[model samples]
Target chain A: MTAAVPNAFDDPAYRQGVVELLGLLAYGEISAWERLAEDAKMAPTLAQEAEVAAMASAEWEHFAQLRDRLFALGEDPYAAMLPFQPIFQRFHARTQPEDFLEGLLKAYVGDGLAADFYREIAAFLDAETRELVLDTLSGTGHSEFVVDVIRDAIAEEPRVGGKLALWGRRFMGEALSQAQTVVAERDALTAVLVGNADRPGAVMDLTVIGRMLTRLTEAHTERMDKLGLAA
Target chain B: MTAAVPNAFDDPAYRQGVVELLGLLAYGEISAWERLAEDAKMAPTLAQEAEVAAMASAEWEHFAQLRDRLFALGEDPYAAMLPFQPIFQRFHARTQPEDFLEGLLKAYVGDGLAADFYREIAAFLDAETRELVLDTLSGTGHSEFVVDVIRDAIAEEPRVGGKLALWGRRFMGEALSQAQTVVAERDALTAVLVGNADRPGAVMDLTVIGRMLTRLTEAHTERMDKLGLAA
Candidate 1:
């Protein structure tokens, strides 16, 4: 089905959707970088701070890639990123971590959920766009760092796990709420996921989106469990 | 003199000084990254925020290089970075910018001053270590970005030049004060500047140190002039 249309950019609706998706992802990277850098401040040691700073740097690199892609498409990269700023600002403001542990959980669980959702959306995109989207979503290889820190924290103070589990749930809830708002407000991006009528071979019915959400949920659950937190 | 220090690393005093210098630099990079990221939040536009973030990422990259070099020298990178953390913390705390423009100027003027000081010291080191130190001190190619923004800002509001010029002086003063503290507290690093008797080729007299400080001040004055601020 994906092979049926080699030039998805030919469809205006598809182009708009792709641009919206790229912008959303680009802004998401910037927001991630900001949040991770903020979290680095709460790190207990210089080594841990450097670890988190490294993650923030990785996010900046991803943002650069997406921004360049938008520029190559002749879209003003900052203008492309503008529409989603308020949404991200609100998400971060509402989910301000109370402590270092909550911040770590948010980075791991929140980012994991967002990446899964974006990857799901990427599947409906043109091959070139899909590849770019997936590549950007490929996280900074610091998940194990986050996991180890969280697990060690929990092992030392058994009660800390419960608080983190709750924080994980809050992150998921905030993220999903924001995701719904994005879907409701961004018609072009929604069309990317639900399939635009004018964009042939891009048609995925409601069932597909439902299954996609389910997969995203299951993946989030798996990640939470890995961190010894209940989803 | 440079050719005579082929095995400078074998000298215990040289090694201690080298390690101390690297630690100072590594922490400085981390501190720079933190301050730049903080400044990014005050950016009026997303593009400007990204410009600042890019600078922060560049610092992180340099930090990685210094950290890896420390590791190769069999020093614990975090321990190497620890001694200078409080000094940087105080420097940043005292020079917190009041607004976006102040932030930009601080980053430009402050970093420029710090780089010049370090580069002057780098010249007295072993060739290989000197090269690494100098390479890390190279300004991220975003000076033009900072210069352009500040010039346009001053052009738009003539009064801004006066305020930023004062800010520039304050940055230089604060940096010098903290730097003096670093030199007084860190005997090994000071030893690097005032060569040890055992480290023959590394011997730099107090006269050279005085000239180095003069060169640093002259460079700072030139940078302020470039930014249309009185030194």
Candidate 2:
């Protein structure tokens, strides 16, 4: 008979949960790397390809860092990631970018939520692992690219504002939907953010979550306005 | 009325051919980054993701270097790259990898041929361009992955020999077919490798090309055999 897999909801779950989450994140980074790298082909200039390629490399580095943390936790990173494959795959399928701008917006909005989620979880981790996740989140290139492309597109064609603004909205909606699914399906993962013994405010309710999301939305809107996409 | 677009194959063509080639190469590198990064998700451990992510990152760096070289030549890198989009997109459609191993093998064999082609073209370029191309070709991570995966797979499953060996054959056949198409359709690109100034024994001909193919085939065969797939 096959052995039943250990549930990570317990302290026994620590090793498995750490490994699995890291694997999932590593895979996410990997997919992001490939998307950005390949999309660089759509770039109109050699210089642009270089810029996108560099950005894609940052995703790969993030994957590496997460993988390293998984290793430190004694997780078999690939096995840990295997369970969530369909989930991540479905999310990507539902949100496939149609063009260069869509691609950039996907990265920008998608990584923003990812960073927020990781920040929440990092507080549950030991110092070293938390530091690694923090550093990885800090290294995001999506915002820079998003700001540059939106500004350029607006500067070149003021008519792009209506289309891109709508596209940005769709991107955010899809990303938030996937994040909610992730949180709902994984209670232990939620515990990483909400069950901390040391801090009373470590866990937040729906109102606080809504406020955070609102702030992010406001920032994104401001960025769009700065790029003349929200005139 | 729109001005006549310059034919790239014409003598004294205004389009910068070298930069165009670099754009294509840089795009390929970015695509490689994406493929490898995504494939790393199939890994069974975090360490494996790290290994694959590092490989993906290397592809990005290669694209960066090629992009810089193109910029130095005073061409608008994007404009140079625009002509070959359809062809590249078609190649990608026809040759999508089915799995992690397939993706890695694609990188290994496909990029190896591309590196050889780049080296041949480098020989035809002036001193600076030659050095730049050579430097870009030197740091490929594809072969190392190929060797590692093939070796490990063979060690783990002695019976996987036939499937993988057959897959290797398909890889080479598809690659060579696409290469021929590239050579036939891209005349100036052919000129880049065939040499602007002919020298006896400097440029490769059909016989020399055949010999090189034979070598790569032999190496691939040896790899398959090492993985216990020779039967």
Writing each residue's lDDT as its tens digit, candidate 1 over A61-178 gives: 9999999999999999999889999999999998899998888888888678767876777667777887887888786778889999999999999999999888777777777778
lDDT of 1 at A101: 83
- Individual DockQ of the candidates? 0.84, 0.30
Cα misplacement distance, residue B32 of candidate 1 (Å): 0.4
Q: Give the alpha carbon lDDT tens digit for every residue of A1-231 in model 2.
A: 234843333364344445656777877887777677656766665556556667777887787777666666666666666667677777778877777776766666667667776776776675666788889888765476567876788778877777877877776676667666766776445444443323324553555445656666666666556556651
TM-score of each: 0.93, 0.68
- State in Å the error of residue A186, model 1: 1.8
Count of clashing residue pairs in every prediction: 0, 13
How well docked is model 2, in DockQ terms? 0.30
When summed lDDT is taken over every stretch of 10 residues in candidate 1 chain B, the lowest stretch is B195-204
In candidate 1, position B82 carries an lDDT of 93
Over B104-181, each residue of candidate 2 has an lDDT whose tens digit, in order, gives: 666666666666667656766766667878888877754665778766876787665566667667766765676667
DockQ score of the complex predicted as candidate 1: 0.84
Listing every candidate in turn, what is its Cα RMSD in Å to the true structure after a full C-alpha superposition? 3.1, 8.7
The Cα RMSD in angstroms, rounded to one decimal, for candidate 2 relative to the true structure is: 8.7
Residue B66, candidate 2: alpha-carbon lDDT: 72
